[model samples]
Target: MMTPATIDPLHTPLCDLLGCEVPVLLAGMGGVARWELAAAVAEAGGYATLGMVREDPALIESEVTALRAATDRPFAVNLIPSATDPALLEAQIRCCLDLGIGAFSFFWDVMPEVIARVKQAGCLVLHQVGTRQAAAEAEQAGVDVLIVQGVEAGGHVHGREAGLDLAVGVHAVSRLPVVIAGGISTGDDLAAALRAGLDGVQCGTAFLATGESFAHDYHKTRVTAATGDDTVLTDVFVLNWPKGAAVRVIGNSVTDALDGRLFGHDPATLPRDAIAWDGDAPRLRFSTDSPLRTTTGDMEAMALFAGQGAGRINDIPPAGVRLRDMAEAARRILAQG
Candidate 1:
């Protein structure tokens, strides 16, 4: 039998990054992060991240206000340099400074100037990278933390050549604290990540089933029903946006139709055929849509975003309950070591 280790809340660097009791961060997702969800994670003794690129600066201000009102616990805001408008990013930074936001998560080749600005503003700067070189540069640039995203993640995968091995990234560099993401859906995985020398695990797919998540009922149901084979990565979704970052989404008619068409077609000329429903309906699509829809019960068309670890998730529950269980399980697993 495997031996258990003691729970050491203060031993990990992730706890220092977010000022939380533990290093379990709820990874940010555009259009899926909500104030209630973020606050619930913080309340449950885990860090929460609010996505920055999905909305305007003023909306972010409103979200910050709502989040602040809900909980005084520290939380993070994830920003993508490639996707966010420059002016809007500056404004968001200014607002975060004004509100005293605890931490900032950045990715996609951030400028040195932006890094300096955020540092000067008294916010903890966290960089997301897929390569060992990026992690070294983040350390050189003076970032406070490093989030290493793997191939099995739900959204844009970085390191196609390096693969989604968390051990590679964690052991690749010793200069900074590494936080591993992608396919982290269970306490066993979390324990393994910690043993691999990672500071913590950032999980997006695991939290989708939480009640406070902004995921639609159909989306949540699909995620609940998914297996390891349910997800696929392709550039079919965000072709309209620049770089057209590859995303892993659950298999559906939309992904099925575009199967091999992504290589040849001009993304601009692609026809929009899916009905965009906005009012009162349970299903909805944002501007950054790919026409793929997930089904729930009788519903056939709704978007379901899931990571390759979809097989690990089996049910939906409140955010607090799930997080509590994960932390307890991880603590127990660690104690066995």
Candidate 2:
């Protein structure tokens, strides 16, 4: 058998490693992950992370400032090295260092020099990997933690297998503490993963429905209303975003129009049925939304990122409340066993 794990919220290997009360962590959702949400998650006893790519240097600094202004607890900054420009990534890392960021979660494989620099600066590094080979390489590079991302994850996914499959597969090869991402919405999922040998769980979509998230109300409302079947994985946003990574989004007019084809449509050919108002003006689009608070289109028709476990999420509460509920439920379930 594998190592025994817990979701007690008092201390797991993850909690002891990261100095957080709970093993649950907020997934760094890029543009969707803002300072408000990050601070609240950290304050709620789970580890939080600032999504450190996508935006420019100034914006990242500002968000770090915002996060600091809100919470004194430790948090992380996540970067996708494969998708981020190297120079920008370096600058962002430097800025984070100056800002006193103690924890960082990196997407993609870890580079030796980069990991060296971050570690030298006294930051603990968590590398997210999609395969066993990548996990082995990360451990070789001295990654303090491993985040196993599966295809069922919302936002961007790197693994061909689902979360549980990858956790088990990677566990067989490496002994690194594993935290799973993808379709983790409830306590049952957390309990199952821990019992199967994962050290922790990082949930994105269910947390997106929490009050502190910067997502528009329309988007949050829709997530609470959705079931697992409502999410679909696609690379349709390649023009303005990364090219090949699978982004799991809720089904809407845009996804329906694409019909599972990635690059067959002209932008002009999209239907303008979904509408939202700006004072006296009406905005229309099939989908150009990243689901920000500023999004003013029919959000259901926009790119609403969600995982398959979204079906189990039924309410919108504070981040702390959600964390407590999941932890309590997991503790109870683990107690029975």
Candidate 3:
């Protein structure tokens, strides 16, 4: 199905390592990459990732089980070094190996235990890096893939501003497949990244708009309705959590109020407890204290994290339909040659 103009043959080291059909990858969108979404991507012939940033040991195992049950295709698990309790991580890794997860996505520096276990389990390691230096270090650490994330990415910014240089950085260091994330939403964007020699594209904003995403309906709708200027990167809300880190989110009344104290805001300024969504329906809102509410519906002033590409989103579709559509579009564009 590859075309002359289409760089479908550009399966770099990571895709080969993970055994995915396309170099394209789902950027482990935290709660958004639930079983349904993950399986859908795999079914559509892309590598799907389940993010376990704030997941508990039991919940992680269950989700992994569900993903495996949904599809026989390969899928990945994303582990956040900061959020994962060491003991809990060990348990989760054991479960991943036991269930035979195809790949493991890492968020921080390659820790020895993580590296050792993942390699021992025969899983490919997809290491995420925010900077070129970190990308090189990850290569040295022996990651099978290098994810070059930019400041335009949702969630954590990783303290880098090289939005345009994301793919360039990855190509500079490792021979592995390089996936460019942050603010990428369209075929044109994907094409541009590939033309820059990137192995593939990993996107969050567009996937977040998919119907299969576990994100609250309110949040999904908001992202779809957002414009180019609707998003802003701020560390204000995320820094308020107990294990707070920097995150990029849309600016809201609550976030706007904290502009003066972006780095200095007291945790008290955020909702003391989780925002109470009245209906059984998901609530989309920015909740510094609750990670679940942040993803699954409840879009009232909640910390709805989205990349700048959110501005380009306009509709919601199921994950399978969306992935197939994108693939078809890419195929068409490539065929033009």
Candidate 1 lDDT over 110-191, as tens digits, reads 5678778888878788787777777777778888878888878876666553233753555565567778888888887777
For candidate 3, give the lDDT. 0.72
Tens-place lDDT per residue, model 3, 211-240, is 778877777888888875777666566532
C-alpha RMSD (angstroms) for model 1: 4.3
Candidate 2 residues lying further than 4 Å off, grouped into runs, are: 1-10, 262-289, 298-301
The 10 consecutive residues of candidate 2 with the worst lDDT sum are: 1-10
lDDT per residue (tens digit) for residues 1-337 in model 2 = 4345532433678888887888888988776678999988888889998776656779888998989899888888887766767788778888888888888888865577788789899899988888877888888988898889888887766777877998888877776788988899888888888888888999899889999888787778888998889988876543333445567778887688776684444444445554665445444553334566765646565567888888998899998888889888888888888
Error of 1 at 331 (Å): 2.0
Q: After superposition, how far is residue 147 of candidate 2 from its true place, in Å?
A: 0.7
Best by lDDT: 2
